[model samples]
Target: MAEVTAEARIEAPTGKVWERLTDFGSYGEWNATHTNFPDGGPETLAAGSTFTENMKLMGFPAEVLWTIEELEDGRVLAIRGKGPMGVIVGTRYSLAEDGGATKVRIDGEFTGAAVSLMAGKLKDSATAALTESLRKLSGLVA
Candidate 1:
């Protein structure tokens, strides 16, 4: 298994950030990473809530089927999914207050033949992409 983690401090309150984070329904609007998010009613996102999103990784079409594994208000969110191409992936998002800012961390685990072969480069790309995505999220909510 290969993992990559990225953290960013945003100039926003935890409440504001949480709202944006949980607004999965509108991810495609401002989220640069996801291109096509499923059209569904609002999701409560408790354990077992499932979502489907079509996105791109390195400009290649990727479909993700995410199921909420855990949730802790203002603290943690974890989701797991698997896709074609032998992909097994998990994502975790955590948030904490730091003075006047919110510290957000995104950690990802990917295990697959294709991922293991380029683990090093994937780590670097994940770091960069997550950082930029967080920055964008902060800006959108700021």
Candidate 2:
């Protein structure tokens, strides 16, 4: 298994940050790993919602069928998904309001026989992507 976590303190309220982060239509504009969302972001975010997303990881195009596992409005959103080659992937986005700023964190995990083969490279690539995504997101909302 490989895991990566990244966080950023954006100069904006949690509600403002959450609104931009969950905006599926503009996702490609600020999200670093986004390639496309065939079905788009969830019409409404809830625990049982599902979405199909196409993304690039380690410069390889892959698709993930994701099911929302948990939701807490502007505070948390977690999803578990199946990716190419039988890999299981999970990502969690957490937000907290700190005065006028929001502290956002993204935690991701990958597991499967395929993941083991390139765990080191995958971790590095994923970490960089997450960090860059947060930077872009921050710029958009802050």
Candidate 3:
């Protein structure tokens, strides 16, 4: 298994940050790993919503069928997905309102037999992607 995390203190309000975070239609614009959503993304991100997205991880293309596990308007969103080769991926996006800005954190976990082989490389690539994604998101909203 591989776990990765990244956080950023964005210079924007939580609502602004959340808007960009949950804007699935434009995910590829700010999400570093996103390529496209072939079947489209959730129009509403409430719990139980499902979406399919194509992404790249460790330089390999993967299609993920994701289910919204948790959602709290502008505060938190969590999703668990099944990727190729029996890989299970879980990701959580959390937002906290600081004094004048919002602190956003992304935590991701990968598990399955496939993950054990390249856990180290996956961790490095995923961690960097998370950081880059946050930077892009911040640039867009913050």
| Cα lDDT, model 3, residue 83 | 98
lDDT of 1 by residue, 1-142 (tens): 7787888888989888888888876666545557776655236779888877776666567888888898998789898887668887788999999887899999988889988787887677766777778878888776
Question: In model 3, where is the ten-residue run with the lowest total lDDT?
Answer: 37-46
Error of 1 at 15 (Å): 0.7
- Rank order by TM-score, top first? 3, 2, 1
User: Model 2, 1-142: lDDT tens per residue?
Assistant: 9999999999999999999988889988877888999977887788989999999999999999999999999999899999999999999999999989999999999999999999999999999999999999999988
Candidates' C-alpha lDDT: 0.79, 0.93, 0.95
- Which pairs of residues collide in candidate 3? none
lDDT of 2 at 111: 98
Q: Which TM-score value belongs to model 1? A: 0.89
Q: Report the alpha-carbon TM-score of model 2 versus the true structure.
A: 0.97
Model 2 gets an lDDT of: 0.93
